[model samples]
Target: MPPPPPSVAGGGRCILSFAALRDRCFSHRFLAAGLRPLAVQLPVGGREDPHTTVHMWVPASPPRNPLLLLHGFGASATWQWYPYLRPLIAAGFDPIVPDLLFFGNSCTRLPDRSDIFQARSIKAAMDAIGVTRFGLVGVSYGGFVGYRMAEMYPDAVEKVAMVCAGVCLEEKDLAEGLFPVAGVEEAAALLVPRRPDEVRRLVRLTFVRPPLIMPSCFLWDYIKVMGSDHMLEKTELLYALISGRQLSTLPKLSQKTLIVWGEQDKVFPMELAHRLKRHLEGNSRLVVINNAGHAVNLEKPQEVCKSIIEFFQEPAYEASNEEKV
Candidate 1:
C-alpha cells in the first residue's frame, strides 16, 4: 500500500515546481552545449550613472557566423532559445542568447524600460565581447528589441529574422480592436501574469492548442519563478514598445530581413506580419506557418529553424526567392 498524498498535495506540487526550476535552468544546458555565462556591466537606458548588467550565454570560441537570439516576454532567454542552440551551432553559427534587462540574471535599477534601451544595452554587451557584427533572431517581445537593434545599429546587426514581432503594429490597433486585449493593462495581465488563470490565458493565446491538463501547482510555481520578476518594469517595456507607435514613423531596415508568423496567431494577428513585410519596403521575406499560433517557435521549431538557417545562409534575397507565404 502507498502512503497517503500530502495535505493539499503539497509534496507533489513541490516536486513539479522543482522540476520546472531545473528544466528552466539556463547555465547547465547551455554550458553543456559549449556556451558560457557572461555578465557585462554596461551603461543602459542611455544614462551614465545607472549602469545595467547584461547576462548572456555565448560560445567559448569566436563564431564564424554569430547570431543573437532574443526571447519574448514569457520566460528567460534560455527557456525560449534552448531548442535552437544545437541546431544553430551545427549550422556554423555561434548563438548569443541574452537575458535582456530585468530577465534572467540581467537587471537594472535605472527604471527606463524601452526596447531602444534594450537594443543599446545588447549592442554594448556584444562590443564588450569583441563581436563587431552578427545576425539576430528575435521572437515576440524579443522581436521588438531586435527591431530596435537593427534600426539603431544596422552595421552591427547584419541580418534579422523576427518571429511574430509586431514591429509594424500601430498603437491605434489596440483601440481599433486589432489586438486580443484592449490595452496595456489587459495585455500586461497576460504577458506578465501573476495568477494561475492568467498563465492559462497566456498559454491559450500563444499556442494553437494549449495543453488541456496544466496543473495549478505548476502554474503557481512558474509564476513565482519565471513570470513575476520586475513586473513594473516589464509592463513599462510593453508600453514603451507599443504606445504611440505608428508604422509610418518606423524606420525601414537596410539589411535583409526575414519575417515569420503563425497563420493562426491571435496576439499580434497575421495582418501585423504582412504590415511588417510591407513596411520593410523591400528586401524582406515573410513565411507564414500553418496550424501555429503566437508561440510558433515552440510549436514549429523545425520549420522556424529551417527558415532562419536558410535566411542567414543565403547570400541575397532574390525577387524570385520571395514567397507569398
Candidate 2:
C-alpha cells in the first residue's frame, strides 16, 4: 500500500507517530468516500460507571436506503468497508459502517459479551443516528451480530447479507472437523493475531491464495496498526459466541437474506454457508464465489458487490435462481 498519510499536530511542531499516521490514513479514506465519523455513547442497563462508545461512518447527505456494513473480527470498519463504498453509493445505498465493541473506537464497560448484547448496542447506535429501517451486510463475526440484529429487530432490519459468517456453527462443529483448527481456542488465536507469524497464518487461512513471501516488517506493521487492541476481550467474544449460543437456539429471521461464501473458505468452511442457507430456508439465496476464501470481500470485491447489489435490487420472487461464480 502507499505510505500512510502525514500526521497532523495542533501545536507548532508535527507529531509524527505510527498510530497518528494510521489514523490519518483511515480518516482520509472515510472522508474521501463522503463518510463522516460519529461517536455515540450507549448507557448499559444497571451501569452507572462507564458507558459504551460506538464509532460509525455515516453518509454526508441523507441516503435513500440505508445499508449497514458490519466488519469482521480483525480490522475496523474502515479497513473492511472502504473498498465497497463507491459501488454501494453508486447503487443508491447509504452504507453505515460501525466498529464493533472492543474493535477500533467502539468500546463498552458492560459485563455482557454475548452477540445479543452486541445486537442491542448496534441497534442503539442506529437509533441514535435516526436509522429506522435499513439493510444489513455482515462478514465473519459481524455476521453473528447481524443475524441477531435481524432476529431481534425484524422491523428495523430489511434485507440481510452474510459473507462467510458461520451463523449455524455449533460447538460440536469444531471437534467434528468442520474447520481446519482443532478447537475454538486455536481458531481464536489465528483470528486475533498478536504476532507477525500469527497474522501470516490468519492471511493464509483467509485467502484462497496468500502471498508466498510477505516481509515480516510489513506484517509487523499491520499487527501494530490493526492487530493490537482488546486481545483478551476479543478472545472472550469468540468463546462467548461458541459457548453461549448454538444452531438450534438461533431464531429464524423473516427478512430476505443473501448468503455469500468463498469456495475455498477454511475458517467457517463452505458447508456452513450451505447450512446457513438451509436454516433460512425459502427466504435466502446462496452465492458461491470461485477461488475466494473467507475474505471474499477483499479477494473478489467486484463480484461480491455485484452479488449484493443484485440481491438488494432484484425482487424477492426472482431470488429462486441462485447464482454461482
Candidate 3:
C-alpha cells in the first residue's frame, strides 16, 4: 500500500504529485475540477426560514430511481464520488451527491453533537427535492449513515451498499491507536495527514492488497481541500460518534444490503467484510473487487457501479414480471 507514482490521463493539470511539498498547490486545482455544482438548503432543527447550506452534484438523466451518495469522514459529497458523477449519469441513474453538513463546502462548523443528527437534515433535503424510496450508497463514515437510514426507514430505502465503511472498533485496532474525540486537537491530528507524503502513507495503510497507489497529486489535493484544522475537527467528531458504539445492530438491517469491499482494502480490510456478512440476514451479499483497495469507488468505479446496478435490478425486475400476471 505504498504511495503510487504520478499518473496523467489527458488532463490540463496532472494528478497531485507527492514528489515535493512545494507541489501542494495542485491539490487545490484538482478539487475544483468538477463538471457542475449544486446549491441546496436543509432546514436546521425543524425550522424552515433558517437552513444550512449543502452543496451537491445532480446528474442529467431521465429521472431513473434516485441514488443517494454518502461520503466518508472528512469528505464532501462530491469528493466521495469525484470524477465518477458524469459516468453514473450516462448509465441511467440519478445520482444525488450532497455535502453531509460539516464536511466540504457545506457547514464548516462542527454540529456540536453527532453525524446522527445530520441524517435528519439529509432526509429533509430528500423531501425538499421530491425524492423518496431510493437506493443508498455510502462510503466510510457515510456508510454508517446509510446503515442508520436503512434501519430507521426500511420502506424508504430500496437498496443499501456500503464501501469500505468505518466500523465501530476497539481503540487498539485503529491505525493511530486513539479514538478521535471532539475538542481534542491531538486525536484529530492522528486521524488526518498534514503533508502529501503522509496522505500517501495513509492511503497505503488503508489499502493493503492490490498495490493500489494514490498518486501524490491525489494526496496533495486531498490534504489541501481538507486543511489541517478541518481534518482534525472531523476526526474528533467521528471518534466521538463511534468510540464505544456496538456495530452488531447494522447486520440485522432488513433492506437488500450489499457490503462491497476491496480485497486489498487496508482500512476496513476484506476480513472485516467477512465478519460483517456473518451478522447480516435477509437478502444480503458481500462482494470483493479484486486488485482494488480502500478507495474502491475511486479505484474501480465502473466495476462497483455495475455491481450496484445488477444487485438492485434483480429484485425489481423480478417483481415486475410477477405483477404482469
lDDT per model vs. reference: 0.81, 0.82, 0.61
Best by lDDT: 2
32-123, model 1: which lDDT tens digit per residue?
89999888888544554334789999888987789999988877787778778889889889999999888888888776788888888889
TM-score of each: 0.91, 0.91, 0.74
- Tens digits of per-residue lDDT, candidate 3, 1-325, equal 1223344433244453333333233223233433345567665556552446666655433246678889875445544565555555566567777777666666534355466666666776777767877888888778877777777778888888877775544444453443223333443453466876655555555544323444455555546645433554566565666555555534467776777888776666566666566566335677778878777777777888777766666664221110000
Candidate 2 lands at a TM-score of: 0.91
State the number of backbone clashes in model 1. 0
- The candidate, 1 or 3, that scores higher on TM-score is 1
Could you tell me the lDDT of residue 311 within candidate 3? 67
Clashing pairs in 1: none
| Top TM-score model | 1
Quick one: ranking by lDDT, best first?
2, 1, 3
Winner on lDDT (2 vs 3): 2
lDDT tens readout by residue for model 2, 1-325: 1122222333332233454466678779889989999998875565422468898999988867899999998777787777799898889888999999999899887678899899999999898788989999999899999999999999999999999999999988888888888787987887888876787778878887777665555655666677677888999898899874578888888999999999999888888988887787777888999999898988888999999998888776544556788
